[model samples]
Target: MDNLTYGIIGCGMMGQEHLRNIALIKGARVAAIYEPDAGMRAASANACAALGLGEPRKAGSITELLSVSAVNVLLIASPNYLHLEQLEEIARIRPLPILVEKPLFTDPADAPRLAALRAAYPAPIWVAMEYRYMPPVTRLIEEAEAATGGVKMLTIREHRFPFLEKVGDWNRFNRNSGGTLVEKCCHFFDLMRHILQSDPVRVMASGGQANNHLDEAYGGEVPDIWDNAYVIIDFASGARAMLELCMFAEGARYQEEISAVGPKGKIECLVPGPGRFWPAHLGEPPVPQVIVSPRDPKGPVMVEIPVDPQLLAAGDHNGSTYYQHARFAKAAMGAAPIEVALSDGWWACVMGMAAQQSAATGQAVRIADLPCAAGLL
Candidate 1:
């Protein structure tokens, strides 16, 4: 069809990022935005004008945005706590293609409700898990899948700056973000599941809020979000994954690193970020590379990292966001399939919740025991 118009909810950091990337997407334009904060609405409108995408209509509320008949899709980038509610509202209004940011719901308790809602509404909902689109990470998935014995072990590490300041500083609180794992590590969890091709069966984790946003109070409310966390997950297929996340590591060069080992060989990747927007690359940017040695030992054959030179210069998490928006536009127009499905998003959130539970109680949480495990398996 013609260019699809998307109405955005939130208009914060991620929303603005989508707006910028949508400019690069030929078949999509942000037609309306519903941000409660007037300043954010103005800023988003200014961005639209600056990008030459035309001024988007300012929507006062979700209801108003839904009322806009011109908008063909809804892009929900709101705070974590508002995800399910907004989704339910959108489903109630009409069946529109939706692109919701990762960690679909803040709390695991909402999982059953979400499932029930989906059964009733059955709208085409796609989750935004951009890590799957990253060039190096995508290569890792390819090598792992092609390996002789499959990926046996996976490791993800993120040492980067503290939580970015969000609108109203909502991200600083666990009550709003659903803990550090759900807020931040969902991307990694999603990636692990995608590469391993298995649903997580159990999880154990440990983390604490020490040196980050909690040091000070915002309007008398202390931030409860943890600054560091380590999570171990056992998948149903016997593949295992471990995550090490530290938000307090200042000046660390590679903000994120990932390694995977299979029965045949291994793959490693480092992502230079948290400062990527400046130079788009700091020093020598880590490229996605792989070394594969079969059981007979081909003597460690190295695989070249796949990168689009155009995307490498476009910034935004190695242009994953740009590709994601382009894919979203195509999917909305029925020209392509949704790469990140709703079930994938749900499982990632469920795993994050399981990790949060295990960390809190110092006990291993079985994925089967979680409330959200009903229909997902």
Candidate 2:
């Protein structure tokens, strides 16, 4: 397909963002959009109008959207719970290029289904793990070889808005969305895995509904998902990772840190976003803090790396993820290599699932038994 036709499911904030970005990607065009909400659908259509991408249609329900004649690429951005239904249908449409939003499946048990879908579809099915393609994160990973001797440990802290209150979607349900740990923290989990260059052998987690509930004043059932969680992961490479996730904070810090204790030295860098909370994902921020030190210091020698404002171009609102999808569109048109395949999304889901299992059982969930372990176990 020369000019790939794209169809988007769901018209929530994320779906609208996909539509907005479809233009930014050269080889693809938004063909149809599916949203059950009338007002939201109209809004997305209006937004697409500005780009003259044309009105998005409901495509006569999910079945037609998958089997439709005009659509080539399908972007599923619907609720966390409904992903499987659409994915299953798409699976029947074998070998079609599909771009699914993050957290491939809410449940690890669904990994088999995902495999079946991919086997059935077998085309370049991709998951939008956008952070992998972001200039800052990408550059940091690129330098991993030159910057480290051996990774000993990594840590990620995500203090985000209370998703239940902010997004108000089915993601609020643990069962529906694979809980916050997997559904939301998939990016961080994958990042941790990427940095360590290893798979988690064990995960220990503890969490409960620390916050994010409809107040008694409002009198409603709150989404029964954890607002705060601490997950500890031990990788096969002898590297351990500690992940902290809290959704109830007044200010959110998307702070990400990677520290590796290698033979030569320890490489540590902190991406300098709002350590407290900043909604600013758009503009250029100062380079994250980086420090390299000898593995065994003589006395107290120090190296303070200078600030780098040009470490990466400006980024915003997971829009860094937008470029990932852009590349997917390009790959659809045979322009660029697809970086994130379906298995990548599955690995993230498996990581999240292990965390969820660890959280529920109050034990160290082993990743050895995952169906899609790639024989790492």
Give the candidate number with the greatest lDDT.
Answer: 1
- TM-scores of the candidates in the order shown: 0.93, 0.84
Q: What residue pairs are clashing in model 1? A: none
Error of 2 at 319 (Å): 3.8
Return the clash pairs for model 2, or none. 95-121, 281-315, 281-316
Looking at model 2, residue 177 earns an lDDT score of: 82
Tens digits of per-residue lDDT for model 1 on 226-284?
Answer: 99999999998888999999987857766777878777667677666633533444455
Model 2 agreement with the true structure over 202-317: per-residue lDDT tens digits: 88998778767644222255567777899998988888988887776635233555555555666555554432244457454444455555646533233333322221212334
At residue 92, candidate 1 shows an lDDT of: 78
Could you tell me the lDDT of residue 331 within candidate 2? 76
Leading candidate by TM-score: 1
The lDDT of each candidate is: 0.82, 0.68
